[model samples]
Target: MGFNPRDAIESVKDIATNAVERSADIVDSAGHILKGDVSGGVEGIVSSSMDIATHSVYKIKEIATGRGDDLDEIV
Candidate 1:
């Protein structure tokens, strides 16, 4: 059998997508914990959700544009 680069890239993309999703879930859960804080609970939840949502979009955009493994994606 021959190596198919597209399949390899797709595999990697799947892995990365899953990782991002799980991390987002963890972060979102943290927001729930912070929601009980009296001073900044709402702010924490809002900021955390917005950051995760935007960053998720950015990562998907990078993958769709064929720059999934670029250093920019890491940071």
Candidate 2:
């Protein structure tokens, strides 16, 4: 049997196309999963930071005014 260059080229084209399609699917899935993780982590950090800030401000105000309504007074 004689080797045909045209047949070889066609075979390579099909394999390359299939590989590209499969790779695209993997990348898309990984991006979506990573995006969700990053988003949730950022939201949690922001919420915790806000809570700390609010508590610190309240404590400072009470201390500066010498108010008996400080957190210690309430608890």
TM-score of each: 0.42, 0.41
* lDDT per residue as tens, model 2, 1-75: 344556555545655565565556555555655778666555555554555555555544444444426675555
Lowest-scoring 10 consecutive residues by lDDT in candidate 1? 37-46
Show model 2 residue runs off by greater than 4 Å: 1-36, 68-75
lDDT of 2: 0.54
lDDT of 1: 0.60
- Residue 29 error, candidate 2, Å: 22
Q: Which ten residues in a row have the lowest lDDT in candidate 2?
A: 59-68
Per residue, candidate 1 scores C-alpha lDDT tens digits across 1-75 of 344567557656765676576567566666766666543645555665676666556555555554546546566
Model 2 error, position 13 (Å): 70
Give the alpha-carbon lDDT of every model.
Answer: 0.60, 0.54
lDDT score, residue 44, model 1?
57
Model 2 error, position 42 (Å): 0.3
How far off is residue 62 in model 2, in Å?
0.6
